[model samples]
Target chain A: MMPDHTIPPSNIASSAARTVFFVSDGTGITAETFGHSVLTQFELRFRQIRLPFIDSIDKAHDAARKINEAYTNDGKRPIVFSTLVKHDLSSIIRQSNGMHMDLIKTFVDPLEQELGVKSTHTIGRSHNVVDSEEYKNRIEAINFSLAHDDGQSHKSLSTADVILVGVSRSGKTPTSLYLAMQYGLKTANYPLIPEDFERGKLPSALPLFKSKIFGLSITAERLSEIRNERMPGSKYASIANCRYEVNEAELMMRREGIRWLSSTAKSIEEIATTILQEIKS
Target chain B: MMPDHTIPPSNIASSAARTVFFVSDGTGITAETFGHSVLTQFELRFRQIRLPFIDSIDKAHDAARKINEAYTNDGKRPIVFSTLVKHDLSSIIRQSNGMHMDLIKTFVDPLEQELGVKSTHTIGRSHNVVDSEEYKNRIEAINFSLAHDDGQSHKSLSTADVILVGVSRSGKTPTSLYLAMQYGLKTANYPLIPEDFERGKLPSALPLFKSKIFGLSITAERLSEIRNERMPGSKYASIANCRYEVNEAELMMRREGIRWLSSTAKSIEEIATTILQEIKS
Candidate 1:
């Protein structure tokens, strides 16, 4: 699988492309998610390839072959981020021609030492339904978030753990959903439409739950860019309208003593984390 | 902070409650998420406490105190699932009277051995936005999923990476949002309403992208229970109506040769993973 000719160092430097592999015996999501988190610290560009459900020796060999191919083709060692629970499978990937980081194997030994108990060393246990109650809470939170999204239903507003307030595209939906999915928080989001801005006050339905509202603020330029993608050339997508709405929303939130955070530079996880902190505090 | 009194062995055996800590310098999400996955393998029930943004020695000391409190209150050593990147802070947590599993410490040495390169050993690097393009993709995917949720907007259906079709309350919204959040996939979900079931076919807008269609099915019992939560004692929440809708939806999907999975026993992550696999194949 090795390439016949080596690319010039100048070409390699210019392209700045590296191959990255996420290998796992299960969904590979955990490995990929944390792996990306680590990889982001490096400035190099990467082409990611995920090989999930690599439960058997055959699958592991295939994965190793893929990693080796990437290494040979690129004339540089590929980086493999793996979460294989089985020692044999992990070892196979570790032996491949790549810089390997096996998440499960790396931590299991220390966990065993500290616990003074033999690790279960199980596979496919991380993502499975081991506890019915946790599963139920997750599903219930998802349902609650869906029901209360964009203020579609207020009949159960009292049940929400937190309600997110923002303009049409200040990123309320994704943040609400992230809170639900990650933390099992029953999140409800309300968009501050033009009518709400003109009214210059909180909605009638929100007065009772004023304390639960956490506002999201975004830059007008970013809002305009997002709105333009949804409805191009519309007055709603205009920067002027966006700026007006944002300023008014902030003013209203401040007057009502609702804490607000600008989401222009924050990721959904960061935004959700901030909201979780706000609600908890 | 050791417990002054011995908890009765009988009570401990019967209740089986333990305290679990997910400590990290960043969001603590990686620790909490994969820690839960690992903890679920054990039958024992845990009260989880998260300590995030522990980037300082002072915060680490506070975290140790909290862990010690859990140990004393529970009359059992707590389980510490940590992802501390800094050595000094990790050491402080290690000194606490809990079974500590430090993720970064466990993996970094081996990674250094394999790569022959020193890790950044940096705090707050994992979750920060180091790659703007990846961040943009995630935000874009989030926007796409929200816009197309429950067939709210079909204007850009063709742009969807995957289109999920399922009956109401069959767990489409959360699954779609999870796909977008985790995989950065442009997912659009459509509910199979009474009209679609009456027509006994896939939606008119779905055929052109037939290959992208994946269906979610749920048991009538579960569907009824879910619906009853939203609209109690109504026909929409009736078991008979749920059975009819689910059956018709499955039939329509089968007739259209669309692959489907039952979401009754699956989490949103599982459902999204299945859909991701379906689309990939």
Candidate 2:
């Protein structure tokens, strides 16, 4: 028999689980992302905390105090993944009773040597909306995506950088939004319904932007499972219906010469990356 | 006179702008993000490219070929920021004509030392949807945010982790989506309109979720600029109307004892982080 691994909240302090902190002078998102990736390599549980916007010396001291408190409470040194840009703030954080991993400085020093230039040592420059033009484009792309979600409108169909077509619950909407949010690409998605299958043609409006169209298909079983969660005990959630829909969608895509991929085992990030490579190439 | 500084596309080959590649076995988002942060510290122009899903040896060889081709064409070594996990793939890429930056292994070695455990060296684990429960929650959050955007529906209001109340164009939709996408927080946003202000109370539906609400206020000038882009020369876009809306929204929030912040000069990440801190605390 397998051993039960669940620990009660009261006994969590003595467990092997470690407390991890992602500390930064900005949103701390970069630190969290890189740290999370690195942590995933281990088979350990982490009670994660984020301390963002620690730009001032006083805030640094407070963050250090929190780290110290965590260390004292855990009876083990906490690991801190820090992306603090300023030297003084990092120095203050380093004084805490923690194993401080200086994420930014470690890479920055080597990069400075390679590039033969001094780093700006600037704070909060990575994700700030300082480039107004780029920021405006991103917001515009988001609005464009929202306005065009699920074939909501055909008014701006001509303006989309890419258009996605798929049956319902085949992962179109999320991919559209991610493409827009991450790459600033104006994306519109249309549902490939029974009506389109019956007509044996692409949606009338989609033909105009055929070159910008991509299709997403999924396994029938996966589609049925997803649909059953949303609408149980209905034909829309039946395995047979899902099979029909997926088959029809794939046939239509093939007939129209539209490139397509299956989203059954892929994340939205993977789907969006593949679509970007295809459309941009 | 100031220098023009603009290089034509035809002359880009001879210019100092170097080509940079983000190569990874997964989505390559972490590589791009960390590399971008590192590059932002330097004052240089880079033509960025993303090579995602390079998990196999053949793909690694192809990526290296591309890097070498870029080096030959540009007469300089292209900078490659790589997050490849397999040592063989990394070695192949390391042999390319680019200055390869092993983003993952560099940190992974130190992490193994700190944690006293060997890494799994998994490929495509960072952004893949292997954790089914977490992935489902994220997708649910996205759907919840979409269903509740701009106060579209009142169903499941109680399920929201946070509700944002703001005047139009004060940056609600993007923040809600970001919160949902990044943190799996089910967020709903309601617009604080003139109707609510005229009534001298919170929206009838909002008061029920007041404890979960956060307000966003923006500068009148900025609101006007954003509105003008949407609907030019209209009463809605006028500065006076914007000032009235901003003032009334602030008054309503203050009267209702709702926590609020200005979204005028902040990114969605910053706004979301601030809200997370306030609510999670």
Candidate 3:
């Protein structure tokens, strides 16, 4: 294996070419995964310099140095697709005056603007876990409602691009990715929070993707089984809680006109095909 | 958050209910990615438990323990899908009296038998590198010619499932995974090794999935660029050695009736979609 520095530098300073730097504090592999998909939604010519394996601020500087060298020879403003979690890549990017996106900011800013709350912080891969007291409370309530899942109650409604209003522990994430993987449909899933049932309203995001949405409901017992694997000490893992959430979410999805499915018994392939069929119909 | 221990033992003890295990020592996620596809093609029912982060003999034992528990209640023999480069789980598995297969053995066994070689005792992920003295000697007298990629040769191939068949750093792995996650396909690739080219054989496994194979050829210059990223100073990273290997592999693939695409000057997406179309048709 040759060292990265030994490769002769490309003429990155060519005025006509634009740099699309994919930046991240973790391995830039995921950004490349998501960014590659996002890039296809555009037609701009760009180069991909994956700045992977960043775990600290100083490492961020090292990654930034490589990007700077790439830009030194390339005249166009670079379009950066960044997943920088550290505090300084923003400054490095800003200083470059390039066309760049800060991904953490993109996800966080919109979420804050839409929900009016700052996200709770987490270390490493669990960073996406809910961090705020309010959101945490809402998540708990949702977790509570998902405990009472009843299968057929939420069956006949249709108003979601990809409805993922499911009980806690239902197979939603894998199914959503499968739908996207096997088909090109835009998918969004919302856990049917307990508040949604109490207030008799769908979570806001579901409504936005409603016309093409489809719900994912699961059996109470199965929900208990899956949740038991994640955090067993809590009441959330109790069968009774799982039963409550399932019934409530099913009822809420039913009342709100969001079509749903019983994911507990369905295979991932089946869930994906079902969603594809519902959307196509 | 759920607890892993609470999974109820399967009550179905009939032969039809036997659970198969798919295990890998490194990134069981990738191994299962391929394993699940194969399992889906068969009628057998199986359970999937990834044992990634298996760094030592103890870790392998721990994985075997979990796998044993999963199969403990079943009446039929457990069929294991396993890929292990080291840290053998063989002894632990043998104790369980279930039918388990190590993938490397399953794949390499037949090749060894047919080639009549007792095996040169190779190690690790650099499966096809010509760094070995034996490999160098083997290729010296052989010349199976194919097309040499000129860094700009990806324009005309119309049917590509993301053409990727190359030596390491020839940019095949990242490019293929990008295509799969970006453009869904039943994509398959075969690396062009010195052995394959020297013997003028398509490494028998490929012919089984031939229609889906797309060769990923790279420019000698570009390959040196990538090779340098890992080893700064070595014969392997030398531009002259790279040029020789690239020309040899490309010529071998073309002459032996395998089609290919270049990874020298294309963005990840271009390489992805172009080859995607090739294999799609």
Candidate 4:
């Protein structure tokens, strides 16, 4: 008998290909981050594709139509990786005969069985976060062993391989932690308080680390979205304060010759990868 | 002109044609995370293999020997995907007749060119973090945000999609925020204080959110490693204290039938992904 010298693959089954629709109800950037990372992990060993995020159910239908057409033409039963809102597009996917990666359903299954409660799945952001179980990482980071000093001016700038400086709500912390996790970097970030911009100088400790310092700035509106959670109903929540802080911070960063990127529209993954490009460039 | 009938090939090369090495200095997992993700993105395009990790030059030499042998056998230039201490592996890789993805070098290239300072690429964790602009995210999580309110009994768990209960340094906040970012979940986490565990009960608000309650526990050593940074030369840093805290937390988690995981040996990615699995499950 011939020895069946088949290459045993990882858990990812290529034949029973898994289609994960990493849909975002909005721009799909968040969906892309989680969805893409997971996809990247399995794509090499599996058949995987991503849908360019569509904003509405109609657009999702159109995309699904194209996908259905493609598989029909190929005479192959390709899995539909739609990151669409499951409720909005479930019927369409079911009828299309394409195996749709309904993350919501996958998430809801174990939750309902173990917990004995059917998830409304309508809890908006809170419900969505809970559904995906993404809270552990944040909780972990809050408690993760961090070798960072946000308040001490990051005095060891000379020893710093890279330093990040950004205004409040610029998506600095998550990005830094990501770089640290992905690239194993000892990332230290300094927040550009209004006083620093008003004084129009880089944090004093940053000069020596100037070569390694990278600035993070976000659009006032985006910053507001992130900050309103913390300081609701304050001048800080006012678009005016946000705008001033953003504009002043950018000018200060420019004056200090600190290279920076806008964290406004970019996902954390994109921000981290872009910074990696800078590090690798 | 020929009609563009072909799909852009999923990957540039085939797996059997490439000699891939998952290399790192400390643990092999960190290197594998980046190496595997990037490689996976290509869709099985290259002929690949992994060399777990090489600590000593002798191991490097032995691994190089096998890689060269494979290259000779395949009659193709192998690509070595590597992450290692800069001081150790350059010569070894250069000695090999193939392409090598030098993650550290890839990470350092942009820094040297832009900053006008040749990166030593020799710093500790700082080297990995600071070389890239990923510091912004890490800093923001620390430099900004609300205060930790562990003792508040009537805390606003009502708004939380999920509540994380654990001891200090058990990774609650980052996980919570990550859940919110990735899945749009509103996560609230509360640490399991000694008093709560002593009573053999979880936190007050946790039972209400039993379906979404999660726990994170770390090993005594890693917990101490993290605690030492905050309050060095104290009982908090002592292994004994770490053991006590861990034992108590684990006991309470089991007694209460609360789902929990060990954060000691896992990377942030592993931990985060695991939590996502549990919650989704």
Interface RMSD of each: 8.2, 7.7, 22.4, 22.9
Best by lDDT: 2
- The top-ranked prediction according to TM-score is 2
lDDT of 1 by residue, A197-278 (tens): 7788787689898888899999999899889988998999999999999999998899899989998877777778767766
Model 4 lDDT at residue B10 = 33
Evaluation by DockQ, superior candidate among 2 and 3: 2
lDDT per residue for candidate 3 within A99-120, as digits (tens), equals 5556455444443342233433
Docking class of 4: incorrect
True contacts kept of each: 0.18, 0.44, 0.00, 0.03
How many clashes (backbone N, Cα, C below 3 Å) per candidate?
A: 0, 0, 70, 59
**Model 4 chain A worst lDDT window (10 residues):** A1-10
> For residues B1-281, what per-residue lDDT tens digits would candidate 2 score against the true structure?
11111211211223377778999998899988878777777667677888999999999999999999999988888889998988999999999998878877778887778767777788866334633567777788899999999999899898888999999999999999988888878999999899988889887888888888999999999999989999999999999999999999999999999999999889888898899889867
How far is B212's C-alpha from truth in model 4 (Å)? 2.3
- Ranking of models by lDDT: 2, 1, 4, 3
Pairs of residues at least 3 apart in sequence or in different chains that clash in candidate 2: none
Candidate 2 vs candidate 3, TM-score winner: 2
- Indicate whether candidate 3 or candidate 4 has the larger TM-score: 4
TM-score of each: 0.81, 0.93, 0.28, 0.50
Lowest lDDT 10-residue stretch of candidate 1 chain B: B1-10
- Model 4 C-alpha lDDT per residue in residues A6-104, reported as the tens digit of each score: 212234333443333433333333333433322332212333333443545796677667667756665555444333434666556556646544444
